[model samples]
Target chain A: MVAVDSHAYASRLRSWHPAEKAGLALATMFIALAAGSSLTEVTIAVLMLVMTVGLAGIPPGFYLRLLALPAVFVLVGAASAGLSVTGPGPGAGADFLVAVSLGNITTGFTAAGLSLATGLLLRSLAAVTCLYFLALTTPMVDVIWLLRRLRVPALLTELLELTYRYIFVLADLASQVRTAQSCRQGYASWSNSCRSLGGLINAVFRKAGWYSRQLAVALAARGYQGQLAVMEAEHGRCPTRAAWLAGLEAGLLVLAWLDRGHYLG
Target chain B: MAETVLLEAREIEFSYPDGTPALGGVSAGIIQGSRVAVLGPNGAGKTTFFLHLNGTLRPRRGEVRLAGERIRYDRAYLRELRRTVGIVFQDPDTQLFSANVAQDVSFGPVNMGLPPAEVREQVRQAMAATGVAHLQDRPTHSLSYGEKKRVALAGVLAMRPRVLICDEPLAFLDPQGQEELIELLEAESRRGTTVVIATHDVNLAYAWADQVLVMAAGKVIGTGRPQEVFQTAGIMQQAGLPTPWILEVYRELERQGWAAGGSPPRRKEELLALIRQAGC
Candidate 1:
């Protein structure tokens, strides 16, 4: 994607405040944790997914596509749990065909296995969805600004901002170098690939160092004194509606905690 | 000219850390509110000269004075000098490091220890003046080249420097962007800011600068009005620069026997008026 498109998304995200997005992310995680049954976890995960779709205005398919990549691990764990038995003796084979043994053992899939699989799926889904919502609904700058407001060290913030800026620059340079190398038949042979990779790494490092020096000099020219200031959001004099939504989310979290027998069931 | 010299560089000679000479025996005095253009070709040490203005680079041999006070080797004085003389680099990406545009613009004012409200006001005014108010929330990495350039200018304006130095301010801009920047520079100069631009574009120097200083091999070869400077073909050839287009057009008119040699027109409007008078 172009930088401008990412910037537009970031600008729209900044229009909302960071605290509100944090509240939503926390509420969804709590709800996903509170559900008891596998069915309940599934239902909560679906609801959270729907909420993200509605609030972030992203397509539901996009979330599903991202979740699919991590689902393979959950499936592996689930299959392994279903196949294991507690009593572990050689069980009778149900069928033998063409010198291949097939077995339907006496072992039944336990509620524990089902619950473990469901929990893994739900936890992974909730964590990924919460992070996705955070990225989609809040600009990274707002998150950094919130960190500064919470009194993060100025050096760390400055480092983070510089890291973010240079990461994109490095990524661009890497892609350009790779394209140029491929055009020169460097990737066709292993030795050529190694030499090309080494050259690219060295070039990128030298360019990054030069850019870093130039950035420092430019900053010094503009009176930079090693401190980065936080950006203050003009969030319309204490957004009453956002506060009400936050209160509602907090109330739901409390109710969920009580019903789960962890606090005051 | 003002009786008080706001900035003075006395026989300043500097070499890069690699021991390559960049500026050799350069001396210049900038009066308050003077719009000066340092014109030179590539590798003429134009950017190095600008770095010396704010003491980003200290002279290896000579001295620099601002507001009648020499910039001591102390860090505090260097900081004060930086706060007083703001520089806008040629590339906005180098100047803007903050995540968002407004934060980038506010960085200078905040570093200068302005109050929060005042910093906010400065950001707004700078953005407004540069016509980048709408881009305040946008990330610096996401802006188009033109918008990024404007935001960099806004960043410097937020510092409210008495002297504004731009390095090749119109280097990669299209004609429209160039015109807009020229207008912006003119407006800032009218506000009593001493504007110095280092550029190879003789046309911009002619149209925007009140006084031009031609540099070749780290030395000021000629300093005068644009017409007077352009009159010397030898210097222009040496610097790998051409005379301004308007000046060339006026010369062509004189060659056609349509007009007599006099003061050359520096602005397009002046050339238009001359052409109309010549019945062309």
Candidate 2:
């Protein structure tokens, strides 16, 4: 079975309209901010995450794995809140413990700090989840095409495309260099590692230079004039699927906005 | 009457920017409609010489002339020269860089500013010629090595060049694939496209090339018809190339006193016929 993840999402999303998706994502963020409560933001974040998991066909474990990286920040904040109470030292803290009001009374610094932390966590999670959905569902090509459509200049798009190509080429060359070094037993010692790494870098630079020259020759042979012209597909206007997705996104935005206003209660 | 030369290089010398001398004092000429093979070992400047054909590289000294016109460094003139002489690189991976096969093949014609319809026609014709029409929609990264080589060839053929310079066209092919390539090149030559190949395979040179130019240490050691060139023991030793297999068999037969002839057959079928006639 194909592993459903961010890469798969990106590939499938290549067929989508980037402008509409970007607009919807922007709308979702605005709605999330206007809904200032931690409860509202957390609810929206969870909903968005669930929708992404379902629509992208990604397993829940995929997202759980990503959460491991961000969990470090959460642990630090929670621990600081618990241990760094500014009142008095422990064992001189009997009076402080009796005097402290921990519930949502809103007077004590501890309660205010907890609320602020909760708000910050919810906001971050909501914003990150929304952006993650955007990244997961959008292909890099669609982003480039949308940039072109939005009049982001031709040179930038060309550079981006070439940069993508060169990255893959460099990655392949690095792997090849590593394999060659390993085969030659150059990684057996620290000095050998340093020498091998230096040699690899030199080789990579030389190969890249040679490749650029060859590219120039190939381009000249093909009569290239520095500008890249892409062959776009011949589909008329926006497809029906895009309109449906846009309407769904608008509906979700309105619902989130209303929930933030407490209109349902 | 002597045949007029289509391309000529006189005392050409070249060195890389790092001061590595690639080619030194090389002089050769290709006559119109002749199939020439450049034979050399690795790092012997065969590819560097091929790059000079269409002015991809300029000689530090001497001159390279095509169709009696000296190759210039001017951009417009270089484009015109490239239109006439197409190069197929040794590595198809470097040559075929487009996302799809059709786009890769159409690149040359489109870059030449052909009309859309004409470019499509050129691409179709090239794909048909190279037997890659079915692969037009396939991604270049997904193609097999042989298919990628064919796609690269089609990319060059779309330019409709009068001369096709192939660098090690059979380097990585199996025996059958090599035979297929030899036949394809022979057919292209018959269609009046001057074919110049740089290769390390002596047997391929003997079987396919009308004329062979052997190089050693950045110098042209010998140039003649393939049979005559292979017979020169000193030239073969200098080029670090073995004599052709058919020539070896002819020598063995001669030593055993079973064959008497003016010269041994260079062609494989002719060699078989001669052996049959000699009853061995």
Candidate 3:
């Protein structure tokens, strides 16, 4: 998670207008979800990967590793969808392409089930790639700023900003406590590890509370009056970049339209 | 003329909600345009006293005065007070709530409701002053400890407060980082801002502070010129503070009749010059 965050900050496209990137990702995602086919989904995924890795300068190895994380869950879900379970009766498994008897039941793979699973997997992955594109290019601060400009409630946006900042703080605190526990041999055994983990959580919780109090004091010292107003460096719209994004999305839309209802194995 | 007191605490007493006394009858006056160091061990109420200066924590038994005016807890008054007194907390993590450096530095100016252009200018100036201008686009969490400390100072400095209070400004910084931070604070002081720092480093307090306030147990045990306060062996021992090396060496030279009878040196160079003159 920390690596992803740092990569976002270091992204070559980080200085690009956040709205442009967000709009491109969201529009592509909408097209993929609405008019999705195997070809269209694959195109969306490829385009996102290119933008995230090639344009944004995210290393391909790291990007593939990140994609692999979601691929694991999607693979499991698609496998379940593809496998068909039928009754033990003689005619129950007639439609199954390949069947195996398991005690009182028969399970097999079916053509339609496999196709449905493939479509589901492709669509989910394409949508995920679109999100990763946005997350890898835009820092959370820019995202919060974009939300603020979109008239999201100030309370919600402020909470998001604070939460994003504190996530790193709490993570660091937790790791430090874990290290201290390990140094004291608190995790020398199974029971000891359990007790040590519990102690780490307790220590982090207490320290989080302490940090909150200190944050309040610090904020108040700076004249914080119920609002976390900050000045963001405005990024003016570049017609060239906007046009490029529009052209890319339009290409994806065309692909989606042509591939409507078309599925491939 | 005597220096005017910019901020004063009149025998202020405070305690936590659970009845642990944090500050007991603490009183000190920060002179305008002077660098003051509040030296104490942990839990000596330096942070609590700083909170009171900015109206973050109201005192239970006394009043805090800013520029001879009594501080009020009303919204307008508190706002005015905070605008005049900015605090950089001990930990940069708590003080910096924004996700990025420029946004964090701009928080104070934005809250002050300055015009966008003016706020931008102030943020730029503050970042430049703290030598963090290049890091303005960096994320807060990605910065090193020293960089974060500078950015934290930049955030407070953007407000252009008259009295800047830093809690443990030198804590957790490398030697080079400490030197850079002190230089920044010195620059701020040179600009006529009353810079106050809370630290436990006896040598730092002696060499850098124009005035020193030594606190032992929620009370100010000594307050005066650094030379006088640190030379007071009884108070230094009471506060659990060691004499600065320069002062100690100078005293040793004097004891051997190798130093002329005059005011003691506050810096290493000054002490060396004293010994050179004695040699002549």
- lDDT score of residue B254 within candidate 1: 95
Give candidate 1's TM-score: 0.87
Across B1-280, the per-residue lDDT of candidate 3 in tens digits comes to 6899999999999998999999999989999999999998888889889999999888999899988999999999998889999999888999999888998999999989999999999999999999999998788888999999999999999999999999999989999999999999999999999999999898988999999999978999999999899999988888888889998898899899998777889888988888888889
Candidate 3, superposed: residue stretches over 4 Å from native = A88-93, A102-105
User: What 10-residue stretch in candidate 2 chain A is worst by lDDT?
Assistant: A1-10
List native contact recovery per candidate, as a fraction of 1.
0.67, 0.23, 0.90
Name the best candidate (by DockQ). Answer: 3
lDDT of candidate 1 over A73-139, digit per residue (tens): 8788765664434332553432222122236334444554555655666666766676666666666
DockQ of 3: 0.83
Residue B221, model 3, lDDT: 92
Residue-wise C-alpha lDDT for candidate 3, range A84-200, written one tens digit per residue: 887756667457777787887888888887888898899898999999999999888889989999999999999999999999999998888888889999999999999999998
lDDT of 1 by residue, B1-280 (tens): 5456788888889999999999998888787898889998888888998888898888898888897787785778877888789899998877788877898898888888888999999999999999999998677777888899999999999999999999988989998998899889889999999999998788878877777888889877777777788879987888888878888889999999877777888889999998899995
**Can you write out model 2's per-residue Cα lDDT over B149-264, one digit (the tens) per residue?**
88888889898988899989988888887777777788778888989999988887887787899988888889989989999999999888998898899889888887896867
Task: Quote model 3's TM-score.
Answer: 0.96
Interface RMSD of each: 1.6, 2.5, 0.9
Candidate 1, residue B139: lDDT = 72
What is the DockQ for all candidates, taken in turn? 0.59, 0.26, 0.83
